[model samples]
Target: MELEEIFNEYILKSEQLIITKRSMNDIAQNEIKNLNQKKEKEQDITGNKNSTHSMDFFFIQDVKSGETTRYKNIRSTVDEKIKQIVLQKNKQYQWILSESFEIFREFLIKSYAYLGYKDKNIWPLKDYGSIILSEIENKDYSFFLEQTKTKRDVPESILNIFRNTFPEYKKLETCNKLDVNLNLEINLIEHFRHIIVHCGGKTDEKHKLIEKIIKKSGLWNNGKYDSKHYDFISSFFRLKESNDIILLEIESNNQDGFPNKYYDVLSDLMNSLNSVAYLIVNEIKTIVK
Candidate 1:
């Protein structure tokens, strides 16, 4: 299978999106894990003989150079490997060939055209090195996933994606720095838009509070919020006329605190909240097939 055929006919690369090589790789890692996990889930759901042994293939959780994360199938056929390789290479291809690399922080709003996604911008360079790369000390590329604003669905799955992407950021900080630095108001909360969309804006009380906050605020284009309500927060940022500002403001009244107790090692990409969106999308696609 070719990259063009798979991504173009299948993957829905959202506009307002451009991923660094590391970020894109993180997504691919997460996607693979998600697929395997789904296979496991199905096995469990059916209670089959294969349940006696654990799957030899599991998502790579370490955030170091993902060289060790390559697929090593014990008995996969040619067709299966082709599909896997496409997913694998596509992840790296998006970042290595992102459109935003050239003009500093200028957002390139066009798909790779190499793969499949239409007129969607690749990840911006300034946002990566100047912004995320600087904050992270010398780590790997995946470390920058902390900067991503992903949708909500499988919490475990999304967390996995972030964990995988974190190291990539750590690694890239070695040789690059943003030419023009700007303060980015990073809002790491998943509740900002995802929760409101998951349950219709007016479904219940918790959701209503979300709807109320979003309505009173000036974020909405007219009266409508996101389609799924879990759109990436940055996917809808308002840029100033001067092209010098990235407005990322949060308006949550409730006191949100991080215990920092449960925080330990990060999970693999399949468990990532960010990466799970693609996984679910893939899963659904498989179902449709």
Candidate 2:
């Protein structure tokens, strides 16, 4: 299919996914609010504010032995239950944002291959230094090459491929709406994605790549927080250094943590995806014409 068609389809599918997620979030929030109100009314009527009489409960089962253990009957207040729900929702948001980045990466790989098929000159430059290229099955000039490798998940490395491929390729325009450094923000988002997926939502102190990403992305620069780190970093992460290891503290439980109603990370992901894909698609179109 044409790059334009692919872009359109991606946009449509992404919009649908986001709409469904938001609708579900709204429903859950409303139900929680209603439940809280109902509990309050019941408490007023019964004059038992400290009532766990109508709280939630669940049991844990051992799959190996088919043994059901009555895990402490979580007799908690409505507020506490709401907090748990919010934590789960934040986890969901993080997954969605990270998955979007992966999807965009795939789209970019496709765009690169398509451009190369249209013109072999779109391949890596001499300075790229002997990249081992392999032709993708069923695609004429789709070179599945080094930049898309698992170890090379850095956003700058992928973007650098495009810059090297296209003589006229320029830096992505600053996202005026978000008013953050797109380059740095994209790198940070990818770094967060790595932490969530590989390190179970914690920073890997031993990973050299993590340290490099932190330093270059300005999360920690020159042994301290960068001057503009808070501008974009505060939206998705809380940073700290522990024993010379950068620790990323995700602010999930706090309602005011996201500041944009938990859409900040996803918004940045969408913007980066759209900006990169559109530029690649437009450039490819121009080349083919």
lDDT scores of the candidates, listed in order: 0.32, 0.59
TM-score for each predicted model, relative to the true structure: 0.18, 0.71
Model 1 regions lying over 4 Å from their true place: 1-73, 97-103, 106-289
Q: On residues 1-289, what C-alpha lDDT tens digit does candidate 1 reach at each position?
A: 2233333333223222333444554665576666566566767797542333232464554567645564553555333543565444543432222221211111111111111121112333432444454543454323333223232233323323333434432232222243210111111123322332343211234444445444433235676776443233333322322211111222334445733222111111111222323333343243233
Candidate 1 weakest ten by summed lDDT: 179-188
Candidate 2, pairs of clashing residues? none
Off by over 4 Å in 2: 48-50, 53-71, 125-155, 165-169, 174-178, 204-214, 218-226, 238-265
**lDDT at 195, model 1:** 31
Collision count for each candidate, in order: 44, 0
Best of the candidates, TM-score: 2
